[model samples]
Target chain A: MDVQVYRVPMQRLIQGNGMPQESDHGVAIVGMGIVCSIGDNIVEFKESLKKGVSGITRLADRKGPKLSVDIGAEIKAFSFLDRLYRYSDIPETLLQKARHCAQRSPFAIQASVLSALEAWQDSGMVARENDPERLGVIVAGESTTQNYRYGLHAGFETDPEYLSPRYALQFLDTHQVGVLSEILTIKGEGFVVGGASASGNVGIIKAVQLIQAGIVDTCLVAGVVADLSPIELQGFVNVGAMVRGNEFQTPEQASRPFDEQHAGFVFGQASACVILQSCDVATERNATVRSTILGAAMNLDAVSTTAPSASGEARAMNEALRRGGVCASGVDYLNAHGSSSPLGDATEVEAIKQVFGDHVSKLRVNSTKGLTGHCLYSAGVVELIASVLQMEGEFIHPNKNLENPIDHKLRFSGARFEKARIALAMSNSFGFGGINSSIVFQNAC
Target chain B: MEKENIFSVVKEAIADVLPDVDTEAVSIEQNLKSLGANSIDRTEIVMSSMEKLGIKLPLVSFGGVENIEEMVDILVDA
Candidate 1:
């Protein structure tokens, strides 16, 4: 069979760049809301990125004390109850729902509330006024894995009579999505997407596809880093995929993506939401299109579940660029899936270099995990926010703690620098099961 | 457990499930539905209460429980 490629032609190019857009393929990012270790809001996050302040902390939560790898990116002042009340006018019903699943589900709920609300507020979409069926919600996470790990284990040991029926509802990722849906009163379709660390990318990419397919006029793509329990953290420790010890002076400096001294990824927790609308729906509402999701694609390495595959990753990126009608040379920046794992970082650079050929040096690639740790499902979404910030500011953030470059073949942002306007950018996210995903984004000119 | 003590435990369970609730205002004979718990939430609350009270009330006994009083009776009698 012949290798086939397709394109969604440029509608009317935004004023800034000549990149394609304004066509059926243009899914505009109208709003973004985030709550991460770096900062609770975009203002703080951008400042932290500018200063290169690391959000990785010494594990101090319920799971923090149990792990040998104690360092991670936990929201420092994060208390689910406090955060929920502080950020949102959460109703009594939602609060009741939250209290019901208070055991292992509040982390995603609380973070989603903060992020989704911010996105909604920024979006100016009155769900009550708009067709509720046209507004949808999708969350990406691994929280159900944590729930099964802890809840089921505890349920087995406890007396059935005393078993909280709440545990019965704990296994569904939709519960988290349900909370967001209820809060927004969005009656459209909703579900969860998980592609390991790429889950956020998968979730948002899925949302973009839905809107482009006319499945809905608007969608909220959310990825909340779901590490509410200790078992998931211990899973990483058991697999020897976590950075450990007092080798690094500060816990914040522990994550060093693409650095020669990179040991492994430190887990991080947070949440982010991107409000996407079909270009017409967005502009009709006079929404501010922060950036347009030009194209997205995902694939699996079926070759090796645990081992990273450069060929599979290259294929996914190549497909995404081809779908967006973006040439390898046209990509101005790349937000890498550089999780800092010994093999992961090397393999990703190999993929980028292999896919882009001589255009590798033009792609100013960087990773946010250097400061925030690996945000699990939210990694790609949070990094996409970083990419938008780069385009808006015309500055690419430094890959924090990168004292030495791993390969230096790509234009890795070793230090924060004011750069030319980023007309088109891409973000890569590959997960544990060889799930490689990429999305092409264009700045709204 | 004394009747008063059982009521206290039931109220404690209510507080655990709905931390924002004013337990004093919550009546013992009030329907469990008032606790804002669906069957699952009520089960979780009762199960957690059992964990605290060191009792093992059968889930079958929890069926048709109307209010905090019935739930407390099921656990205290067990």
Candidate 2:
């Protein structure tokens, strides 16, 4: 399906006139949900942003030799499933299937369900009349696929009889997406997106397309990861991608992005989801449109499989801004994909300079990763929410631990409240598979 | 072992599987299905209860049982 994005002129979108545009093609975000080490929902996450609380800490539960750094952004408390009203009958069937299933259940499924449920409630779509047939769900991420090794171990030691009926279903990449549709009873297109770390934005971008094309009234988009596993840890160790927390006084101080004392990203698990609907559908239902996705673009770096391509990143940025009909200077805030890895952060800064040019000095940029750690697939979604919150709450969070600057030329919001006159915001996400995605959102007029 | 002791163990195991279930009103004679448990939940209850008791579940007999009493009977025999 063609992804129709950012084609509407900026003025038409901004001057919404409080009336549903006749044949509204633009898509708006009606609700959002998130669960990570930082906070459970947007309210709590906003508080964390205000306090500049870093969620990274020592890994608590494990089953192997201690990791060299042994640090992670661990979610300690939540009552996600308990709070959600039973929205579908599939949960009963899924529970029945999984009870005896030998598959090592990954954490992303639960995380996605919680995040999606919150978004569903936040939108209040259930209270109003809506076409269930027009509701769709799309979830993406695969960082934890390696953690489903229990069945492999059992099969290798003995025979395949040890594997249960739900063994394969439990770990399939698209299985978590099905869980969301089942839980929500969304009968529309449901699938998974695999854009590596940029998975969340990629999925959201696609949902906007489906909505703009009038294919679905609402799309449940999510990016989730349950990536804390021995094998996953060892892989990061082998690649030297794990954050070196030795020099830091504390684990929370490890992920200081765009700082002179930059290291690597802390491995964190989280789920972020949003409900996207056509502006007309949202208005017709009288739902609170959090923000509108003015435009989005996804491209491959194609330079290196692992290393970032500044040219590709810049192109994506230009495309999204152009499609959104917003000028580079118009973007008041930038949610940069500052993973804090030496190469990724530096490359992203260069890409920002290349795309923004003279506007680079005018931009107030910050990386939420400094607070929440790198939440893998959900980083883009989480960061996008942070950007939206800045517009809604009248504050952009500080780049915590940014005492020393990487390039003073780039105006990093040094933990100061810039009374958000933010009319437009841009979020960038780059994944390991050379995926570059940029999304532009406009404050609801 | 007393059936009352077996009831305590069974209650604990079921509680582990279903945190929201009221174990106080539950009796060993009640059907697992009546407790809102499915086949898999029943298996989990059995496995957890056996693990707590430090005994291996006879999967065949466990599969054939329809109620909590059958589970206790298996444990008492073991």
* DockQ of all models, two decimals each: 0.65, 0.12
Q: Please report, in order, the local distance difference test score of every candidate based on alpha carbons.
A: 0.78, 0.76
Residues A190-218, candidate 2, lDDT per residue (tens digit)? 88887878988999888887776556889
Instruction: Please report, as a residue range, the 10-residue window in candidate 2 chain B with the lowest summed lDDT.
Output: B50-59
TM-score of each: 0.87, 0.82
For the record, the alpha-carbon RMSD of candidate 2 to the native fold, in angstroms, is 6.4
Residue A310 miss distance in model 1 (angstroms): 2.2
TM-score of chain B of each: 0.86, 0.89
Candidate 1 iRMSD, 1 decimal:
2.2
Give the number of the best model, judged by DockQ: 1
Stretches > 4 Å off in candidate 1:
A1-24, A61-66, A88-104, A126-128, A143-160, A228-231, A238-240, A417-420, B34-37, B72-76
Each candidate structure's count of clashing pairs: 9, 1
lDDT of 1 by residue, A296-373 (tens): 999988854568999999999988887788777778888999988989999998899888899787778889898788
